[model samples]
Target: MLSVLTLNVQAAALPRARRLLAWLDARDDNLIILTETSNGPGTAYLLEQCRAAGLDVTHTPSPDGDRGCAIVSRLPTTARPDLLAGVTLPGRAVAVTVNTESAITVLGLYVPSSDRAPAKVAKKRAFLTSVIDGLRGLTEGQRAHLIVGGDYNVISRNHRPRYPGFLSFEYEFLDALEQLDLADAHQRLHPTTQAHSWIGRGGNGYRFDYLHTGAALTPHLASCDYLHQPRDRQLSDHAAVAATLRLTVDHRTAVSAPLAEAAALS
Candidate 1:
């Protein structure tokens, strides 16, 4: 089974992001995704922390700072930018392919929340389109398993009423998601989890972070949930979302199971 934990640690400063590390430390997942880390803290620090907590880690930074993304894991994975599709956006999402004996590929994506401006909004929309197109290559029960996790910065109507500018933007994002036949693991698997990642300057909080996988991934979907226990109004204001996927043991399951059953019959 391959389980992945994804979080946007706001800034990777130790004191500021210690809870983020602690939260990850508790989970024994196969993979971990951390987005929005500051360049000052660097990928080395996050990798070191993951090693201390006993996970093999690797990270790829976006050409732009703060747009950097990282992937840490107990599972053996090779990080590559070639696997990602180009959207001409400021930041980039790291595509980490876990070379399991299963031959499965899991791409981790972090889409940014462009602020309110015509240009920025247009960029966000274009980026979303590219991401969907990039991931559309996957075919069910075969090829690769695409698991995209990131701070989308769009709030869902199911969680809270639409924020002022979010009305059109959020709908567009969701529509793009549906168009690609991908499922938001949080909403589909666990709807009760609190809206996480942002406490707006306005009165309400937001659930901008997500773990989205194609319907082809349904079999491996184990469980999904959020940690909203201690709502820190000041300390970065984004809660973490975690997901567990019970992956098969590649072809070994199908091949060995039948043989084993045959042996039992004999």
Candidate 2:
């Protein structure tokens, strides 16, 4: 069993930040991600906090907005070309390969919000399209286990938005995920125990965080949850989403055969 957690930590108060870090410390979640990270000082501060706690931080920012995204992973991670190339998206973006007890690859992501201005919105679309294309190169996690996670911002049938009017964006997003054939990680589990990552200040709430997986990975999903119980007033207006999955493959099977084969031939 391997666990991954995603949150938009709001980057507000030191106390609130500490609370999040403390929560992570308590859990055995192999990977942690935060979206809408404060660009400079606050990001550095949070990075330090994670570092002191023994998490290695990898950060990235968008060209159009003050907000950014970060990956805090305990498991060994290597940069993926899709994320390392640094495509021209508006907000912060990050992608990493998490080597866990069960799986070798987990995509650590933070996509741009569609709520930003017109140009930023356009940039967000570009980012989404790029991600879709990048996902195509990935091997389906049937005999293998792979995961794509982050603040997806748009939810599909597996999830929905807090505000009803926000469905327009979600509709498009659902279509995209459907087109990609990515299954909602939470749906395979008991829906009653399911939770999402958002709590509306207006009292509206929705499940916006996600773990998109392929058909083979769909069944391995054992549990999904949204940690909505707030420690403070508003922690970046988004809660954390966590999951546990029972993978079918052993760690040895997860090794990249292509790379190994190439080395053998050489």
Which regions of candidate 1 fall more than 4 Å away from where they truly are? Answer: 51-54, 137-144, 157-159, 167-169, 191-197, 229-236, 248-266
Q: How far is 35's C-alpha from truth in model 1 (Å)?
A: 1.3
lDDT of 2 at 215: 60
Number of the top-ranking candidate, with TM-score as the measure = 1
Total colliding residue pairs, candidate 2: 1
Model 1, residue 148: C-alpha shift (Å): 1.5
Question: For model 2, what is the alpha-carbon lDDT of residue 126?
Answer: 72
lDDT of 2 at 56: 57
Error of 1 at 154 (Å): 1.5
Pull out the clashing pairs in model 2.
62-91
Q: Please list the residue runs of candidate 2 whose C-alpha ends up more than 4 Å from where it truly belongs after superposition.
A: 61-65, 83-86, 101-103, 139-144, 157-170, 191-196, 231-233, 247-266
Question: lDDT scores for all predictions?
Answer: 0.61, 0.61
What TM-score would every model get versus the actual structure? 0.78, 0.76
